[model samples]
Target: MKEVVFQASLDGNCLFLNPAWETITGYSVAESQGRQLLDFVREDDRPCIQTYLEQVKTGKQSSDHPVIRLSHKMGSFRFVEIFVWQTLNKHQQVNGLSGTLIDITDRRQAEAALRESEERFRQIADNMEEMFWIRDLRERKFLYINSAYEAFSGLSPQPLFSDENAFLDFVFEPDRDTVLRVFQEVEQSLSYQFRARHRDGSWRWLRVRAFSIQEGGSPSRRIGISADITSILEREQILEVSLKKEQELNALKSQFIATASHEFKTPLTAISSSVELVRYYLNREPQTPFTAVLTKHLNAISDRTTGLDELIMDTLTLSKLDEGKIQVCFQEVDLVALVEQVIVANFTNREDSRQVAVSVLGDPVWVTIDVKLMSHVLTNLLSNAFKFSSTNPGLVIEFSEHAVRLVVTDQGIGIPEKDRAYLFGKFFRASNVHQIKGTGLGLAICKEYVELMQGYLGVDSTEGIGTMFTITFEK
Candidate 1:
């Protein structure tokens, strides 16, 4: 049998030598003789070599896993992992040691690159706003979820993914079946829109896209991203409502143009006939009996024409207000005088004008307002009061200070509570008050005028008792 060769040394400088080492370093046995082992090691690895030598000198089992760069035969460094063990003398004294070197540079580089790739993936998942998730399809459990999912859902992914049924429970009831169906069709496609409950108890529209990970000819994993689309949904709803309002306004404008043309023509025709009669009759003989009657009929025509003119002016004012084109000039004006003028203009025919008492209270002072608008406001209120209170002859209009108050108290049938809310709305008439003829725009126009003057207008009524329309202006 051939004898096996071994390398051993007592001095640390001439540590271990082997035929394999000489072959690897391109040094013959004779050339390596008497050379310090440190001389053959790479300069940067000398310290680690010394440490391992010290451990062997103490007769201890030195750790073999030493990451060192060693000199190759071509004078270049070779990265190696070394495992060393100590040899002991018969008397338990330290002698020498043996070690095995394995080149591991390629394996180390691959491991380092893999670690960097994983770190990059982690950073992206943490920073994304969209919720990201991965699930083990075979186990029917979530394997990972990004931070955004926890923020939106008010729950961490751990418990949700731990139990297969937990994720199904969190899905909105209406969307559960759809989600399941889409998930089952993962082999075909894995993208869908669905609603999910948010942390704030609101629902969010989410677009989810996913793909299946196949293993061994079967789907084993799934990955997806979920994005919130709540704002998009809200914008769509707003656009829908705005479009509906624009259509309604267009229809209203068409009807208004037709009604206004007819209303104006009727008054103009009456005025024209009266003017023609006046011109013809004035040329007739004096003291004629028909003169007084014709004159009286002409005056009646003038009054009706004036009333129609006022109605047209009111409608124009309302249109300007709607278009935000009316410029109000507010100033201090006497509330008492304003109310008195409205009463006289609307009720000059009252035979018992003295019977209607007008009381001025508070500072009897002036309030900031636009007088023209305020006059229209008072006219609407007083006209409504007179129309509703012809049976109750003693109608009272009152005024006060801190606010200019007008109480058009009547003994007429009052408005019901249910109808009060819509009283100030355009074209609204009380159910009981419909028997009387009106444009149904008086109170609504009154409200707009009052509000433009920075005042409030309202009505209080009880069916069968009486109705009181009140206007209050800030002093």
Candidate 2:
């Protein structure tokens, strides 16, 4: 913002210095008036400044000056950018030089600091073993990715970024659906393990995470990382087979799960898509018996398909947790909004949206949890509340400075006394609720999940009154 105006003779002697020059260079107009312009310039820069003035003086250049540093009255040099042009007499001959020197010391220093900071970060990112990336979710393109990506994948990012789906082409076909599914669930940050094609003609396991980035309270982009987890997956594969020939049997169980999940997901995704199409067409048709019937069936298909997708994911999560293969990513999350979302998803099929009442008793709750896993835990509890309750279900969230507590209460047949002791055992179901269909893995998975998040789960119930599941975690 500083500008010092000056007029100089053909030989570069200062003939005039404006008042602004005194404030910038710490030299009064009287002291600067009769001095040579090059006398105040740094010795190293005087030549370039002189050369620029001479060029303009001979009409070889029009309106330009070389940037130079001037010695200040305080015995320091201040960087300034000069813009000079030759003044012309009425006869069109060069008369003198007129110019302005704008101080840019602070701006130059800032630019240098930024370059150093970027280099520091670049060094760290380049040497990382894991592949890190940031994507502009709005544009569906990568903003940045590290060198490790090309080193591991043996593929440059140029083409992959050019075509949005080009990266997916390298994913194993069976794992593609799950990968695409995760990207579409864009409301929250999530992570999962999947297999992808590697450069050495082998399949490698990758643990990838995606987080929705928000600006102004809305999603603006995504940031994610992918790490090679083949060794971990190999261990899981070995552990799944008989101990005698464990390593050799690596392919058996992993393939079983992958194949089973792929089969389950593929058909469900197709069914849901088809149902949506049918629903869209039916909406345009007049209200008739056949149309009503078709619409109802389509709706049923959509709901059932979604339930199946959840079931597949939950089962896989339980497997990972039991095998000690699950990786937790803890980050700050809005516990209240997460709980509210779970409730909304569960009650989507209900006649009244208020079937499950959620009461947040305290201030906005923020906690550190693996959002993907925590969401699964909350969804299980909330879904159970709605499924078992004959009347309206009640959810209470109590958050304090020291801790957070959530209580999900249902008004249906409670856990029998005998079953209460083994309620969390895998496949253990209460005898009274045998008619209700369930995997019996819900409570067991939830218990492991809550504990994994460094929290505790408890239950209170009477025979026919209800069951209230309580969760507690230190803030």
Candidate 3:
């Protein structure tokens, strides 16, 4: 039998014991008989057994089912429950006490482990920075809430148990509707960001995420976490304001540059015209040494004026590009024809012994590009090529079914490795080309123009050896 029955006198001495007593305590029935039942109980729990026996002796008739520890013959202990009843003789007077013992060690041990696990969970949740909660939707009650909620809402968490909306009352007025809608519409999981009023009446941002507990295809509970995000939102707001201010400052700077470049053009034009008139008058009697010196100085002034004018024009173009004033008009142009036109117009009067060799891999390659911009790009590239190289330069035009490439290769004083990274920046001159007469805006302008036509401009160069500039476009 799983249960052991025993009979003891009112004084608590055992008179009879079932055979199962041997299985329970590892002691034979004969060894267990005539011994006090309290002898088998743990020292601390024996008093409980004694009280139970006293109660049964007073005609209590039933045991209180007190749990007590029983010692085994091997010196180990087991938890057991005691069930007692009073025996009555023919005269109806209580004569003996009878009871049953049932082993409950496994049940008691399981309950202990479960209590320990719950304690650990509570410790972790209470100390977390985020608010953790469990709500029973069917019962309309909050089953669990950690202490962090009190810190977040600035109110005691106790009131939240009775009022489901107590915590939501602190949500920012504008966000409360949305928060409620989300709660009503959420099926399985939820996530949202909202603002709430803290205890000090200051607003704070919070992000919440939740999962629903389902029962029979419907939600019956929700478990969720909410975290404070006020600092993160503040940082994001600051960054947005900074970016907007920077953009406005850049626009104002571009406008100022365009205005200044325009203001310089009138004076430069007057200087060029006066130099031409003076040259016209001096050429009529330019035979003496004095007159020849006058003529030379006039030519120098004219050249310098022209250089200044080119610089102003480049500056204006850059400002327009920054202000989004330039318009792009892509059209089908013959690449071979455009190359020939640029070479004839720009490099024809070069006094250097070096020449430009045009190599046409496929004749008359056609591409879609802005004619004016592409011409300017080609002119700038070829001008740089001829100006930098003392040896012959080469321009190759190659085209296939889907793409076209223009390569301008020159054996010039190539750019330094350190300067290549900033080559396309405005007014950036190479470290090795300080003596070269350049405003440093030509390549920058060329790059912007090329990109406007949906093309790419790239260069490969080695210092003092050679440089190659490639422009590629989709055909």
- In lDDT terms, which candidate is top? 3
Task: Show where candidate 3 strays beyond 4 Å.
Answer: 1-164, 187-192, 198-201, 207-229, 362-365, 400-402
Deviation of model 1 at 275, angstroms: 7.9
Q: What does candidate 3's lDDT look like per residue over 215-329, in tens digits?
A: 9989999998999999988899999999899889988888787777778887888888899888888888849999988988998898788888889889889888987889999
Quantify all predictions' global Cα lDDT against the true fold. Answer: 0.72, 0.82, 0.87
Where's the lowest-lDDT run of ten residues in candidate 3?
A: 55-64
Model 1 pairs in collision: 64-82, 64-83, 64-84
**TM-score of model number 2:** 0.49
Model 1 ranges with Cα > 4 A deviation: 1-227, 230-263, 266-272, 275-314, 349-356, 391-404
Model 2 per-residue lDDT tens digits across residues 49-77: 87888788787975545679988999988
Arrange candidates, best TM-score first.
Answer: 3, 2, 1
lDDT of 1 by residue, 93-183 (tens): 6577655666666777898999999899989997999998888877787788889988888876787766755665557889999987886
lDDT, residue 312, model 3: 86
Number of the top-ranking candidate, with TM-score as the measure: 3
lDDT of 3 at 353: 55
For all predictions, the C-alpha RMSD in Å is 19.6, 22.9, 8.5
